[model samples]
Target: MTFEASLAETLRTFQALSSLRPAIDRAGDLVLATLARGGKLLICGNGGSAAEAQHFSTELVGRYQKNRRALPAIALNSDGSLLSCIGNDYGYDDVFARQIAGLARPGDLVVVLTSSGNSANILAALAEAKKLGLDTIAFLGRGGGKAKGLATCELIMPSESGAACQEAHLFLIHHLCERIDAAYAT
Candidate 1:
């Protein structure tokens, strides 16, 4: 495809995700509620999605805007030592779940991201989150795979391509960061 075609395709996918603004707003509200209730936010994913999980958590736990107080957001995928030990002891699929069980409190927010939306680790984590009374959300593409059915809130990308879906995910997280920052502003 030409550059113009690629650009148009990218724009098309973004336009599709734009339709999910209300749902994203709802997710922000959920996260804000969790924070207000003194519950931490936990996030996880695989590969690029894993990176996005960390990126989003960093925004929350650090500063998204200038001179903001830190919040509590943990990315389960960030600690290689914990992941390795758990995966070695149990199985790879249970790595995230085990962490969630240990760290997540009731009314916490757990955000799971998966490009295919069917990652076993992510699914297991979501199940654990639900069991622990977390407010769950998913960033997924291609019909949201199994995660859609499992999540309390889902942001499904309009496109089927991985790149497009991932782009949508990034934008969604950015919006969340901005909203969270504004919500906490005194």
Candidate 2:
């Protein structure tokens, strides 16, 4: 495919998901509500998804835009000690769950990203988040996987390609963050 064609395809796929603006808007509202109520946001994923989770958390805890007050956000996969200890003792599936149990409070939001939506560790974390009464969201692809079923709100792109799905997911988070800032703007 030529450069233009490839870019067109990418943009088309993004638009497909973007068309669900109503749902995305609702999810963004819930995120803002959680934060407004003094609840934190926790995110998790694996590999590239892990990086995305950290990126999202950083945007919130620092500022997606300049000069904004820091928001409370945690990327559960960032802490090496907690990840290693949880994996070593309780098993990999429980790594995120253990951290969620320790840090999450009622009304907090947990966002899980997985292209296949079946990542064991992430699903386990969702389970824990539910138990803790936290609002949950999942960025999923490929039939929305198990994470879709478990999350309170899910945004699933139609793309089956992992790279495309992840790229779209990152942009989705960016939009979410942007909406969050708008809703909470002073």
Candidate 3:
């Protein structure tokens, strides 16, 4: 697609997301509440979504736009050694699940991002997170695939285009960060 068309599509996706403001606000509330209750976040995704997960984690653990105490957040995809070992020993699908089993505590939040919403590792991680009594959230595309029913809360982008969905995910991440910062920054 041409640059103009791509930009237009992205804008259209943003417009579609505007209708989801209430859900988005609820998601922000959930994150803030979890943090206030001393619960950290464990996030996972694949490929581009993995990068997005890391980005969100950094924003929470570091800073979004305001100076504040660091919040606890971890991206499950950040550890190459753990991923390799898990993938080698238990198969690739077990990577995030294994980590969640070890690291997640009750009341922690697990956020999974997937454009297809059907990635095996993400689904496995969600299942593990659920079993461990962690609240689960998903940022998904393509009608949320099988992960929709699994999430305690979900934001499913309105478009099937991976690029569009990913773009929307970034926007949501930033909004979440902003809310967190506004609510907690000292």
Candidate 4:
């Protein structure tokens, strides 16, 4: 696709996100509630989605737009050594799940992002989060694939285009960060 075509697709996807407001609000509320109770967020993804996970963590732990108190958030895929260790020792699919098992507490929220909701590691992480009795938010695409209905709240992108889906996820991430900044603004 040409750059213009891609841009048009992205705009269309973003426009459709208005339909997800209630679900997006629920996702934001879960984040706020967890942080309000001194709980952290455990975020994970793969490839570009993994980068967005770290972006989400940094926005929370550092700052989005406000000079507010720092909130706790971990990008489970940010630690290369830990991910490699788990992948080599357990399996690639166990990387995020192992971290959730080892690090998550009762009040923490698990956030997983996936352009295609069929990755085994993401599935494992969601299952682990559920097993631990923790609430979760899943940012998904491609009709939510296998990971649909697996999360406490899901913002399934309204587009089937992979790039458009990811862009939509980032938009929601920024929107959620705005909500966080509002809640924690100094």
Candidate 5:
């Protein structure tokens, strides 16, 4: 696609996010509430979404715009050794779920990102989180695929283009980072 076309599509996706305010705000609220109670955030994704997860966690654990105490946020996909071990022992679908089981405690939140919302691992992660009595948040696209309604709260990018969905996810990550930084400013 041409630059102008890409820009237009991204604009449309961002515009649609206004209608998603309630859900988006709830997601932000989840993050703030978990942090306020000294709970950590456990995030996971696949491929590009994995990178997005790391970026979001880094923003919270490091900084968004200004100085703030480091927050607890783990990107479950960041550990290659652990992931390969889980995948080898259990299956790729259990990679995130197993980590959630082992690392999560009460008051923790599980956040998963997927443009397609159909990955087996993402689905497993959400289910594991819910089964453990933890609230789950999903950033998804393409009508949330089969993962819709599974999360306690979902931010579904109303678009079919995965690229547009990913772009939207990045924007929301930054937006949430701003809220987190302000809420826990040092």
Candidate 6:
């Protein structure tokens, strides 16, 4: 695609995201509240979404456009040893779910990113989060697939392209980080 075409696609995706303001705000509020209650965030995803998950966790645990105390956030995809073990023992689909069972607390927030919103691991993790009484949020695309109904708050990117969905997910991640920093900065 040409640069101009890419830019146009991005703009259209952003425009579609504008309608999800309420869901985005709710996600930010959930994150802030979880932190206020001394609860950590658990994040998981696949491929590019996995990278985005780690990026989000790093922003919270380090700093996000500001100097501040670290927040408790973990990217479940960060642990290669644990993931390999879980995948080996419980099947590949149980990686995130297994980790969630072991690490998540009641008040913590579980965030899963998936362009297809139909990854078995993500869906399993969301189900596990619910079983463990953790609130779940999904940054999803492709009409949210089956994972939409599972998330407490679903930010379904209004795009059919995986690239567009992933791009929008990163935008939402940055927005959430900004909101969290602003909330604590006060």
User: Could you say which candidate leads in TM-score?
Assistant: 4
Q: What is the lDDT of candidate 4?
A: 0.95
Q: In model 1, how large is the Cα lDDT of residue 18?
A: 66
TM-score of each: 0.95, 0.92, 0.97, 0.98, 0.98, 0.96
Off by over 4 Å in 2: 1-9
Query: What ranking of all candidate models by TM-score puts the best one first?
Result: 4, 5, 3, 6, 1, 2
Candidate 2 lDDT over 1-186, as tens digits, reads 678866776777787986767768778988888888999888999999999999999999887865567899999999899889889998999989998998888888998889999989998999998888888988888778877778888888777767778899899889988887776656
TM-score of 6: 0.96
Computed on alpha carbons, the lDDT of every model, listed in order, comes to 0.88, 0.86, 0.92, 0.95, 0.95, 0.93
Local accuracy of candidate 3 as per-residue lDDT tens digits, 1-186:
999988888888889998878878888988998999999999999999999999999999999999999999999999999999999999999999999999988789999999999999999998998888788889999799988889888999988788999999999999999999898889
Candidate 3 Cα misplacement greater than 4 A, ranges: none
Better of 1 and 6 by TM-score: 6
Model 4 earns a TM-score of 0.98
Which consecutive 10 residues in model 5 have the weakest lDDT in total?
177-186
Clashing pairs in 5: none
Q: Which stretches of model 1 miss by more than 4 angstroms?
A: none
Question: Looking at model 4, which ten-residue stretch has the lowest summed lDDT?
Answer: 158-167
Tell me the lDDT of model 3 at 5: 85
Instruction: Return the clash pairs for model 3, or none.
Output: none
Candidate 6: minimum summed lDDT over ten consecutive residues — where?
A: 177-186
Ranking by lDDT: 5, 4, 6, 3, 1, 2
1-186, model 1: which lDDT tens digit per residue? 788877887799998776898988888888988888898889999999999999999888878875577889999999999999999999999999999999987778899999899999999999998888777999999888888889889888887778788888998899888888788855
Error of 6 at 21 (Å): 0.6
**Displacement of the residue 43 alpha carbon in candidate 5, Å:** 0.4
In the range 100-177, model 6's lDDT, one tens digit per residue, is: 998887799999999998899999999999999899899999899989889999999988878889999999999999
lDDT of 5 by residue, 1-186 (tens): 999998888889999999999999999999999999999999999999999999999998899998999999999999999999999999999999999999999999999999999999999999999999999999999999999999999999988889999999999999999898788787
Off by over 4 Å in 4: none
| lDDT of model 4 at position 174 | 97
Candidate 4 lDDT, 27-74, residue by residue in tens: 989999999999999999999999999999999889999899889999
